[model samples]
Target: MSKVVLITGGSSGIGKSVGEFLTQKDFIVYGTSRNPENYKNSKFSILQLDVKKNDTIKKAVNAIIASEGKLDVLINNAGAGITGPIEEIPESEIKANFDTNFFGPINVIKAVLPQMRKQQSGLIINITSIAGYMGLPYRGVYSASKGALELLTEAFRMELKGFNVSMTNVAPGDFATNIAAGRYHAPLIDDSPYIKPYGDTLKLMDKHVDSGSNPKLMAETIYKIINAKNPKGHYKVGEFMQKFSIVLKRILPDKIYEKLLMNHYKL
Candidate 1:
């Protein structure tokens, strides 16, 4: 039987791209959107789900299990982006980002694990970010949230090993997507000390996304991981330098790496 897949936040961006590609490859794909009605023309079915809402997560997962008898894979792709100096961002905004990017994925995973454990086979792929590998200047909160997911995946892989359920993190760099439009940007206050620096970094970040790699690249990468007999705990997909930065972090002196990041962001 073709593997059944559920992709969260599948209305657009990497999630939509992955869902469409998997559908073409003959996999049973169900994509989730808060407003499923908006994506009636999607190549795959779009289920109503809001990652931040546990009720919706359970509803969507249960619906898939009820229909398919099994859910072979889950792409935890539902996430929001936030950008601003950490100090200036509101406490509520920070918690909200974590709720969506971090806790949301965890709840979805919780909903799927029992079914996956019963089957004794399943793959859970968490879509993380290259920025998660290292804290970027103005993108601190976004980085922290994704980075936390990365670590959570590491721990989950070990815990799920006995159940034959596999989990992994696929961290992608800037990808040309609608993410910028959706991201929460702390207002640029004219009198704030970070005004010029934060504003410049924000523009550069937007430029990177505008010129980023095609989301199709991420889709192809996800497909490969899904087919693997045993996917690794983590996979980084992006331009060479973006992936290499992770390696640099591993080998470089702390201060030196920090300097490189500061230089790159022109902070």
Candidate 2:
């Protein structure tokens, strides 16, 4: 029997590409979107899901479990982004960011674990980001959210080891996607103090994204992770600098690392 797979945020970008990749490999694949109807053009079936809403998440997971008897793989690729100075960002926006990026995957994870635990076999792949390794200049909240997920994945791996479930966190840096277009940017009033800096930072962020690696590369990485008998706890995907940043962050001193990030972002 083919493995059953569920992917979140499959309407576009890495999720969509990964969903298609898994489908091509003959997995029983299902993708989720907030407005699944928008995904009508997609070849795979789309489930209406909002990671922030437990009812929607439970319903979606239940529907899959009922049909397949079990879920083999879950790709927690759903995330939201926000950019601006921490002081300037409203509490509501920051909470919204965490809700979609952190708590959202949580609901799905909690709902799916029971079924996976009973079977004593399953794989959970979380699509984190390089920023999660270190806070970015403007996208600090987004980084925090991804950082939380990465740490959560680490802890869960130890807990799930008793069962047969495995966890993998893939951190892709600046992938070419529509994410930047929709990312929440802190409002800039005329009297705002950080307007100039915010504009410059936003430009640099866009430049990195516009020139980022293709989403299909990430899809391929996910496929490799799924097929590997024993994948590592974390995998970094992106350009040389992006991948290097992770290793450098670990080895470099605090001041040097902070300076490096500032220089890179032109801060």
Candidate 3:
């Protein structure tokens, strides 16, 4: 039997791309979506899931286990993109952001662990973001959420080593996806202080996203990671520039790095 893989938020965007890639590669793929009816792809099973709700996550995982008897890999790809000025974002919005982007994956990971533990070997791939490393100017909450997940991935990697379960955090830079379509915009108040600066920075961010790296490349990277004998801790996907920026962040002065971000965002 082929390896069984489950991916969350697989109705569209990078999740869908990865699911299709895995399915084509002959993995028994189960992709999740809030509304499975929206997906018409017969290549892989479309399971109903809402990462925001723990009960829904439990249900999805239970169903997968019941059907497959074993799960070989889990791709925590479901996430929400929250954008706008930090000051303008409400506390509720911030909580919601973490609930979906951070704890959502947590809930799913917890659900799958028991099954993977019994199997004694499994792989968990958390789809983080480049913004996770360097906090973005306008999307502070989103950055914080992913940053938190990156740390979780690192800590879990060490903890899961005993069970032979591997954890890899994929911090992808700008990738071509329709993430903006579902992105939440913080409510800007009347006479907002961040209006002009945010407008300029967000416009630049949009341009970069529009011309970002291919999602197919991300799928390919994930495919390789899933097939490897011993996957590494973290993988950063994007162009050479994106990888270089990560390298620069390590060696460059803090002030210089901030300046680079400022120049890039024109803030």
What lDDT score belongs to each candidate, Candidate 1 first? Answer: 0.96, 0.91, 0.90
Residue 234, model 3: lDDT of: 87
lDDT-better candidate, 2 vs 3: 2
Give a tens-digit lDDT track for model 2, residues 72-99. 9999988887999899999999999999
User: If candidate 3 were superposed on the true structure by all CA atoms, what would the RMSD be?
Assistant: 1.1
Ordering by lDDT: 1, 2, 3
lDDT-best of 1 and 2: 1
Off by over 4 Å in 2: none
lDDT of model 2 at position 157: 93
Clashing pairs in 3: none
- Residue pair clashes in candidate 2: none
For candidate 2, the per-residue lDDT at 16 reads 91
lDDT for 128 (candidate 2): 93
Candidates 1 and 3, the one with greater TM-score: 1
Which one wins by lDDT: 1 or 3?
Answer: 1
Candidate 1 stretches greater than 4 Å from native? none
